[model samples]
Target: MGRRAVFDDPALRLANNLLDVGRADLHRRIVAALHDSPLEESYVGDVQDQLAAVVTDQRVAERDRREASRLIGIGDDLLAAIGRSGTVLMVWRRSPQQVDHPGQNMPLARYESDGIYQGSWGDIETFESSPELRTLAEALNWAQRRAPHVIVRPWWNDDTHYWAGDGPPPDGMDALPDHHR
Candidate 1:
């Protein structure tokens, strides 16, 4: 048989979904979809560039342009998180109910350890900071105290996780199922 068409690629689906989604819910929808499987650095960069162009294109709708601008911010953050190096710092955003306190959301961070199986990650210590530190940047800086130069990844929102000192992730790690959420 000839080569088969693969129609289930998440990245391709994401792109298609982006085209069909309403402008109002664009950013949140994209974020939720990306949380399932983050795009590669190159793809993220490409999409960001395309969105940037859309933002500046006079032909595009004003609402669409605004939505594109917002997505560019998401792209920038995702790009930064993926580009980090050193230890693997996984940060999770916890809802108020999930935390000891009931007032606000909090950030929880943990480092990835080498698992028993080769090319697998094991869980180690976890740090749950006070609600005062409200942003991912704050959480990352706090977690940095335990391990400097970490490849910070949002745990519940992304699948690619690697240990400190590990160069690029091994093949297929990006395809890991959505287990963190």
Candidate 2:
């Protein structure tokens, strides 16, 4: 498949980007060429093996190992989503900041639909809901129950500042429509 096709497929692109591989090992020498190849079944298996090795190598950086392990989980989730017939609900969160003390394990809802929507908050960690939760409402409800201390917002918006919370949005802010609830 061409680069466009690879980019169009979220699962494939994510696998390639996490694996950080290219058409051949030679391309690895050039940082820019990394993740330029399509993700094949064999490549996915190899990448999983490589990530597993990273996770088990004591000499590797602790952060790298943790990241590898997280990527493995994401890869597994992506594969499962691809195999299933329904939509996959993913929750993501940004690290807490001074003004925004969202507490521990709080999810950050994006104002946009893109899966990798990182605004001023910086990099965010993604969490995939159980496959059984097929809709956004289910995901939001799950998040609300799982982290009641924190506020949750809709996965996407329609240019308006709509948000979802245990109660109606405070004062001036707007709550999500009835259907979204």
Please give the lDDT score at residue 152 for candidate 2. Answer: 34
Tell me the TM-score of model 1.
0.29
Pull out the clashing pairs in model 2: none
Residue 113, candidate 1: alpha-carbon lDDT = 24
Against the true structure, candidate 2 reaches a TM-score of 0.27
Give me the candidate number with maximum TM-score.
Answer: 1
The root-mean-square deviation over C-alpha atoms between each candidate and the true structure, in angstroms, is 17.2, 16.7
lDDT, candidate 2, residue 1? 23
* Model 1 pairs whose backbones collide: 87-164
Give the per-residue lDDT of model 1 (tens digit) for 1-181: 0001111133334345555664334434334333213222354565566566657767557776776776667556642323332343444433333567676655543322211111111122111222323444554444444343344345344444533333444553442232421
How high is the CA lDDT of each candidate model? Answer: 0.40, 0.41
lDDT of 2 by residue, 62-141 (tens): 76567667656655644332331222223432333444555554445443333322111101122223332345565555
